[model samples]
Target: MTRKAAEPSRRQPGPRRDKEPLHCIAACGREVDIGTCVIRWDQPGSLVCPNPRGRSACTRHDPRLNDAPTLPFSRYRIHNPDQAYEELKKTVHQFVLHYDVCWTSRHCHQLLADSPFKGSHFYLDLDGTVYQTCDLYWKTNTAPADDGLGNERAVHVEMANLSWQARAEESGLHLLQTDAYRKTDAGWLLNLPAGRRQELRLQSFQPLAARAYGDRGYFSRKINGRTVRMWDFTEAQYAALIRLCRGVHELLPRVRLQVPWDPEQRRTPLDRLPGFSRFEGILGHAHVQGGNKNKGIKRKYDPGSAFDWGRLRRALSR
Candidate 1:
């Protein structure tokens, strides 16, 4: 089953998308249905994931792929659904979450597309439009947890959120003169520049964080030995994410509808997991990586402090 996506909010979008959901992703001549609105690599105006090193069982972070031609989605190298599904099921066990630290999914994709090798399997936009850059049969170089073998067992989603960058003092990569979110009569709206307004599927969309903490309209907490302060994800993102999680679980059972919960703490832990590499569920990048320079894994903290892990847990439970 699939949910046919409604039209973009304003002017017609380019590279035309399937007005009707194909309900499946194409790869190696096989397609698996995922019941959601996903802009695929084959779609017009797609922000395609780059550098397919190889299939699920054959990936190993090949530098050579940086220069390799990204094959069309319709012509993925694998040609057998049974073999592809079996390999994917065994290889992918965790769904890794991230806050893209960008204004929208298009911005996030621009950064990835410019990089020699960085890419994500999915991008959850501010308006909750999910962009599937490539087939789930391939591995993306999004998060390489402590064991350095994380890519082998995880698929990734780069949800749009500036994270700590929402604040001027904490902003780094995408420096901001002031806070990225502005408080309005309506709510705490992200100050998306007018120039980038068209990036969203909903031109009139107000990118408000679903929840906020106190007067500042952002959440401040410690995660992975550092202070992270940011606004919550949008309500639309939460709803779409839950649906996406359900679809992912249906398609790949091992990547269960669960997050990193600390039973004693009575909430999800916002730090690297001790059994990080062994866990089998949806989790934030912070849950698996506490940067070790010697080990070559930079510290990661994403799907940050403002993310509602408990809310996600409750929603998934149903």
Candidate 2:
């Protein structure tokens, strides 16, 4: 983004009105109540003073009126992305990761730019393309329901895709057969033999992180009387997630690191989560609200069961 320097204003001050109070609309931090002043509004919606021919001279002179300071385009850094991470160190406390469960990155970007969800700091596509949306210093209005955990104090990241099979393909990984079965009216639908299912149960199931940011509902859906839960994420996406998290941590040294699948802290109340404090480190949206039966509210379960916490922890540690 291009940067422009502030310039001097050439407009003269308006004539002083002794009986009337004078006020400046340029936000130049000048007060005009006690005595006569030259401040006046020349036109509607215009910040500069008109400076009428016979009016009193303006007591305040600001150079910025001539040329306002220019911020980077969209107040964001896309080329040197690490600079953006460095810029966020001061104000950001939490780093939240979300999956844009859409089919493609284009759809994800369009959806996020719309109302309510328009505040994410970065977007990482399946191909590892990172797009900086808002300025690092700007606070987005994401996650308002979480009180102190909203866009004001946190940086949000979005990854795109849907389901484990798709995620594995995108990441060049293979999905192993499992005995897990979905119970439907037609009877039990098994992905593998019952004996194999038991063996697979001992292992973790990894799915791609595919789900819209706004979809915070139950992961399971009833299809033809069958309960089906889908989840996924690509290896490239996971690697990008690790890099992103590490970059954020390095920039903001005080931020604590956290993953959603904390076995010891299972079923922890939302209010009691780590986000209540500014010192709390990085955490997942799932950590804030996971599962359909979370306390009283039916919270979201995105970055759902398929996300591999073990891998994420190992990667961050490295």
Candidate 3:
């Protein structure tokens, strides 16, 4: 039996195991077979690995692995973060460029040429109070205060607002409001015929400018530098738009609608409306009424704000 000292058996350096999906264990430096690993230890020290009960290593080598499986996202995850970031960055850069450098409405037009979102949000708060209202509107109507043009264009806008809200509904945009306002003692006063509370309806997206008074429309928003023609209906169009907005609202419930905050004022009547949560964003029209001391109105866009290069991206992608 001693003839030719029996050759010694070679030992493997790492953990011994059959071929399997490779996963670095948290405790051992040695690679253990996936089908065999049974022990759980924190850092890879000489802790016991259960599979063979012999495998062991230190924490330095193998880190914990995330076991979560991959799954598809739902429509609620509609806004692509990566893509939205790109758009936000581009719009922000352009805004910086034209912010003070290009001091004209036309300058703003060129600045927002690549905006991802249609409009910028503006907040209006009454003085001496927390009350605020926010509205999201595309930057149209950027002409120099209409040059005191005929009819001042407010009545035309009023008609347009009524029509546009109806159209937006038909086109599948559901505006939502919050019920929190109803529970307040000030809620009953909201029953007024012409208070801001009445404007709370998602339908009243636009409102008459202070100077224009009772003439402007809710949806008659301004854009870069021109009167962007809304989906003005011929009665037939308005009816169709109503149905569409309701349908779209039903389909995409996440696109919530709500009142904008008015930090300066202590009270906000718009908060009392129903279904305010459906609105996704806001429209800034504080300047539309001539209160913008900075004259931001000069920087607005036209009705066809979509004609700009920025919106073209979305339209083209679709």
Give each model's whole-structure lDDT: 0.78, 0.42, 0.20
Q: Write the per-residue lDDT of candidate 1 for residues 187-230, one digit (tens) a residue.
A: 89998998777998788988998987888999988889898999
lDDT string for model 3 (1-318, tens) is: 011112211223666465532222211112212121112222221121111100011111111210112111111121233332223222210010001111112222233333322111111111100100110001111122312211111110101121121233332332313211111221111111234333232223322211211222222334333333232112321222222222212222222222234457632222111222122322112112222345443333222111122221222223
Off by over 4 Å in 3: 1-232, 257-318
Tell me how candidate 1 scores on lDDT: 0.78
Q: List the residue pairs that clash in candidate 1.
A: 15-44, 28-78, 291-299
Indicate the TM-score of model 1. 0.87
Which ten-residue region of model 3 has the weakest summed lDDT? 128-137
Model 2 weakest lDDT span, ten residues long: 48-57
Residue 31, candidate 1: alpha-carbon lDDT: 45
The best-first sequence of candidates by lDDT reads 1, 2, 3
Which candidate achieves the best lDDT against the true structure?
A: 1
In angstroms, give how far residue 119 of model 1 lies from its true place.
0.5
